[model samples]
Target: MSRKRGKSGRRAAPRRSQASTRRSPVGANAAPAGRAANRSRILLMIVGAAVLLTGAVAYRVFAGTSPATSSSATLLASTAGQAQGETVDGISCQTSEQVVYHIHAELMVFVAGESRVIPEGIGIVGCFYWLHSHTRDGIIHIESPVDRIYSLGNYFDIWKQPLSTTQVGPATGAVNAYVNGVRFSGDPRSIPLTPHAIIQLNVSSEVPAHTFTFPPGL
Candidate 1:
């Protein structure tokens, strides 16, 4: 219903219907392009979520199988082998008839004629065993309620030192183990923990006479 005036004329014929407005090529393609962008954003979010989930699972697995737990298990397996009779190798003691039983034992290490001091404050972390060291004087304090033959192996395990028939810590050579001045021919780990027991290890050298005197009230 639109009209235009003409020069010197009353009115012109009604204008033909305005041609339908044409859509731009760009605008015609915009709707599908917008949809595609939304889909891409959703895909990225999904991928990110999956990656985070995988990382959490991996962390849990590594934490469960940590080195400390593995090493302790291996040492326990060795101790099980040593416990066939009443004592573990040469290490045997009656569990306390009372609530607790405690024993004192000393350890000395010799490498190439030099004394290696056993450090203090060993066996104080994570899961503690019945056998543990209380001081830097190399005094092993065996505190237990259940009777088990705790061996030098258990102490060494708690100490986290490399000890075997062929190796002792950083000193790699034939290891000679002695208990109470007597030489042991079996595996060094089999040495027993007895009250007032004096344990010594000679790595790549002659076993020296233990000069370490027990402290008073040991």
Candidate 2:
């Protein structure tokens, strides 16, 4: 094909377009490098703050705290000594609600159908609870959260407590339960336990049960 020239009548082929620009390696890597730098800076800040806090706590423990105060603090904060069955049994026996001790040397609790986030709202209303009436081995045993709400007969509907005092209190030991902090049943520690029931061998406060034992940490 004949080419046309714009000025002075000189024939010329059309000018080729310049090659499309390519990104330089340095430029291409800049974004990721910037992101990595930002991430590193954040990590360093977190680690530094953690180190500082840990150092401060260590100083308080070793230097600022006096011996007597330290002992009291340790006992209150659970650092001085393990409770009855904590270390020798290889588990934490002490816990608030939502945690429990098990007979198999482990931590335990029950939740219905989920990991216990708002477990009471689930379908556990009439579920059968099978905890022993007496401790089988240790100091304290646990009953079902289900039973705590269900077993009170018509009174439960009127009283509105998850567990009655008599139900949760110890059947036979020093760790008898109290309803609203009052001894609910006969103090298990008293000399005259129900006939055919009290045995010195089973007078422990926390008892590890066997049947229906949930696996440790469950």
Q: State which candidate has the highest TM-score.
A: 1
Model 2 stretches with alpha carbons more than 4 Å out: 1-19, 68-218
- lDDT value for model 2: 0.29
| Colliding pairs, model 1 | 91-192, 120-136
Q: What lDDT does each candidate get? A: 0.63, 0.29
Q: If candidate 2 were superposed on the true structure by all CA atoms, what would the RMSD be?
A: 17.8
Clash tally for model 1? 2
lDDT of 2 by residue, 66-135 (tens): 2222222211111112122222112122233222222211111111111101111111122211211121
Assess the local accuracy of residue 34 in candidate 1 as a C-alpha lDDT between 0 and 100.
99
TM-score of each: 0.52, 0.23
